[model samples]
Target: MGVRPPQNDDDEPDTITFGIAALDAHLERADVEFPVDAETLLTQLGDPDIPYDATGSTVALSEAMDKVHIQHFDSEQELLNTLHPVFESYRERAGNSILGQLRALLPF
Candidate 1:
């Protein structure tokens, strides 16, 4: 999933860049090479606030990255694989909460 775009038209991209099958968006810049450290990724991508589920739940990408024990990732896939369970746990936690249930019902 992706966050809402900036209201200003100048911030919009002209091209349609999306995946056929995906969960969350905003990983990092495409130009960044792999085999990178957490610090480097954090520096390059910034600590973006990303959604964990459709109920408007969110976690800082840096926070999720903290749960990963690895010092460096061989590839983006490896990093994602590592964080998958962490995201799932957060999602499950959110889903199990009473407030999360209400938020899911009413996205306000």
Candidate 2:
């Protein structure tokens, strides 16, 4: 993870740097680091005691990410064009993985 001075009060003290582990690896391969502090914001995401499910969390996180990414673009059309497929792909794959895990844990 890359470290940098805080941008503003609204920004996390530590940024997750490029989103998630997978994204981090990809960015690292590309010789880039976005430096985001996902840890600081995780509590805001859900209760600690609740068992974490990547599928559900991915959708929620993706939505949150989309909101921010959408604002980054100058045009609404650009935002939609970029986010739509990415959101859909994440939803499908993450949803499938969650379902698979759920099935594996079932007695049946």
Candidate 3:
């Protein structure tokens, strides 16, 4: 049988990996302080009550970006270009859960 989907969104473990290398590189280039280190950032993102909410249960893209001081962008496209991959990676690694579904439905 193929892989089964999560029965309860809450039951699904949060296993999303933040592409730390890329994130660090980007932050370094931008001369921005990484609000939280890779490990802490991942832990915070896994929590469902850290202020940012996307599906009412996960960290919002804007919130995460803002945490790292990523407020200004040349354009909407530029912002998306910079962060889409990271969000996508989070969803992909997070697996089939309500959070992932919410991420898919909501615009980052």
Candidate order by decreasing lDDT: 1, 3, 2
Candidate 2 residue lDDT tens string, 1-108: 233333556755653322244333433454422233333233333312211123224434444453453434344244335545555565455547867567546543
lDDT of candidate 1 at residue 50, scale 0 to 100: 59
Worst 10 residues of 1 by lDDT: 15-24
Higher-TM-score candidate among 1 and 3? 1
Q: How much is the lDDT of residue 108 in candidate 3?
A: 44
Models 1 onward score TM values of 0.70, 0.28, 0.31
Residue 17 lDDT (model 1): 26
In TM-score terms, candidate 3 sits at 0.31
* TM-score-better candidate, 2 vs 3: 3
* List of clashing residue pairs for candidate 1: 1-23, 1-24
Off by over 4 Å in 3: 1-57, 66-71, 96-108
Tens digit per residue, CA lDDT, model 3, 54-90: 2323444445565444545554345445655555555
lDDT per model vs. reference: 0.64, 0.40, 0.43
lDDT of 2 at 73: 38
For candidate 1, lDDT tens digit of each residue in 71-90? 79898788777777887788
Model 2 residue 7 distance off true place after TM-score fit, in angstroms:
43
Candidate 3 versus truth, CA RMSD in Å, comes to 13.8
Candidates 1 and 2 compared by TM-score, better number: 1
